[model samples]
Target: MAGIYIFSDRADIAAEIVGFARAAGKEAFVMALGEEAAQALTNAGADKIYAIDGDSELIESYAKDIAEFLIKAGAELFAVGATPRGRDLAARVAGYLDCAMASDVVSVEYHDNQLTCVRMLYGGAVQEKQVLSGLSVVTIPAGKFEPAQGESTIEALKLKADTRVSIVETAPIVKEGVDLSKAEKVVCVGMALDKEEDLQIARDLAAVLGAELGCTRSIAEERHWLPVESYIGISGAVIKPRLYISMGVSGQIQHVYGIRDANLIVAIDINEKAPIFKAADYGIVGDLYEVVPLLTEALKK
Candidate 1:
């Protein structure tokens, strides 16, 4: 039987890929770049670990060598996390290997020696199921799967350095607060807000719940109440927080598309017939101005 291989620079994501392998009744062999990453995979149910003993910078900068490695290793299925950088690397690897590939996969199944994946299409509006023939590359969506657990044996692999991209000083964006994309809880405000000062309610509630604050396109782009980074919509960030509480959001199709993946949606709006109610798991038909303060106080207590 051909072996299943899971690869990712992020240990947490690698853990999730291990989970996927377990769920499919397959053994997960990890290709790790560092000692810490290999240990993480071992603890998270990697059956075997292939450790690369060389300049880690070269692997992170180039996909060609890794693709060649997988192709030569006779990997039946290769998986990685579906982050921006991960997606880019996966595409290059797929191209180099000339293998079938899928991205942002939320579900995976291996049967009859074929890989089937369920992912979103058309900006998360529709779901598509695809089955791959022969060797394939798949990118798992982060936070979508629970991690697996077990111990593993580690082995060393010789480096194949073919670095094409050179790092020119890394710089971090000077933004404050949590990354809303990964936030477990999020509180978003929208056009229903009356004044810029009204945003204090959202800020206070977000603080009380220890959640990230987000807003609609109009609030971010038009009023500029919050930074563009905090905007959640078709043109903004797509999030899948566990608890997403939207206050005064009208739930336009584009806006709802951004939050469709959230586990639980609680919408608070004065308009009883607002479109948001259709998408909300729970909703309140009351003025947010009065409701937010009370909610915050309750959460604090």
Candidate 2:
């Protein structure tokens, strides 16, 4: 019988994919690339864990070789997290296997010996359903499905070959603050601020709420008010914050696409008719300059 295979650099996400496969009533297996990956995957719902002994740098370089392994193992459906690197690896694997592939899949269903998926399109303005013909590959977006839970059988796989790309040294990107992807709460701003001085109010609000400060592409790339890392959009970071508060943002599709998974969206804008209100759970029709300080103070109490 063809089985489900999940590839993740992250054990948590791999477990989640395993959960998805189990929900489809198929055998779920995870390919993990670290010492503790097998145990972690088992705890998360994997039926079997294929532990590849390697660091992230090595595994990433072996994306193609991993695909070869999947093809030999006869994985009917292969899945990965829809992060940037995940997408790239999945595409490369699909190319190597010459199979139909999908990216940023929001939902997956097993049907008639094949897989069907719902995914975002056109900067997330539409959700499209796609069915794969054979040997399917997919990228599962975060927050779409809760992580799967169960214990798994552990197996070890060793890469007997090496790739051209090798990591001589590795250094983490030093950020001065919290990683936005992991932040549960975020306060994002748009073009409403007339000057750089207005950013302090946004920062103050974020501080009060103990949230990360984010912005649209314009604010980060065009206006240079924030770093590129702070930008949330299709070409930037994708966040699933519990509470996403927006100020001065007009709610463009590219910007709104990033926050589609947010639990509660609060929009503060001068324009009541702005597109943001349509997407927000709570909205304030007023100047952010006058409103943000008040909201910050209220939270401070």
Candidate 3:
């Protein structure tokens, strides 16, 4: 039987992985970073839960400790969410274990003593199925699977390890407004915005709607209109929001990669042939200079 590990901060996701493991008739373990998170995983039906104990101040050191424990536990398949922290932790663990690692996997199945993983590539343009060899580490995309449910026994295990490093300092980066990752609504602008003055129209709409502002690579990197961190594309941030408003975005494959998880996509571009129209739930063919200001005014009043 294969051993599955659920790596997550949220109990609900851990529960889903537990359900998947039970369905596959595999022994599952939940690894969390905190006590409260561990209990939540236990409630979700993990057979075993391992909580890493340390000051929240030393994240890298704690991650290394957890990685070592997972390797020693003989976990056959390690799974983590594709979130920023999850990705970093998984990579570190995989590197330590000297195993192959895959990211953005949406589904996994084991048959005939081999684990098959399905992942999305090229901004959701293609699905690739890979059969991992040896010990495998995988980072699953969020919101792709259901959490485990039902009554199950939970056991907390204690692990001992030596710390090789210590945290020297910590500081928070202060910024005004909401983080784009946590924003409920997002307004994205693209190269089709034409002149820099037109960007104000998009910003005004975002302010009126209480939404975070995002842009494609061209607008952010080339024009320097938005910060590089605000670029949303395959090479940038992957966002899943309740509402995503696209203004003058042509919807290139790279840009679409980041917004595939949006529940609602509204695309506005004068070019009806723009690729984004195909993915948009609502499409408007018009000049963004006129369309955006009208939208801003409408949203304001």
Backbone clash count, each prediction separately: 0, 1, 4
Q: Report the lDDT tens digits of candidate 2 across residue range 63-96.
A: 6777778878887888888766778778888887
Residue pairs that clash (backbone atoms under 3 angstroms), model 2: 45-150
Query: Could you list the CA RMSD of all candidates, in the order they appear?
Result: 3.6, 3.0, 4.0
Which clashing pairs does model 1 show?
Answer: none
Ranking the candidates on TM-score from highest down gives: 2, 1, 3
Global fold similarity of model 3 (TM-score): 0.76
Q: Give the alpha carbon lDDT tens digit for every residue of 54-166 in model 1.
A: 65454454567777777777877888887677777788788888889988786888767578888876655688999998888998877767898778888887776556566
- lDDT (Cα, 0-100) at 175 in candidate 2: 64
Q: Candidate 3: minimum summed lDDT over ten consecutive residues — where?
A: 153-162
Cα lDDT, all candidates = 0.83, 0.83, 0.78
TM-score of candidate 1 versus the correct structure, residues matched by position: 0.80
Candidate 2 weakest ten by summed lDDT:
53-62
Error of 2 at 280 (Å): 2.3
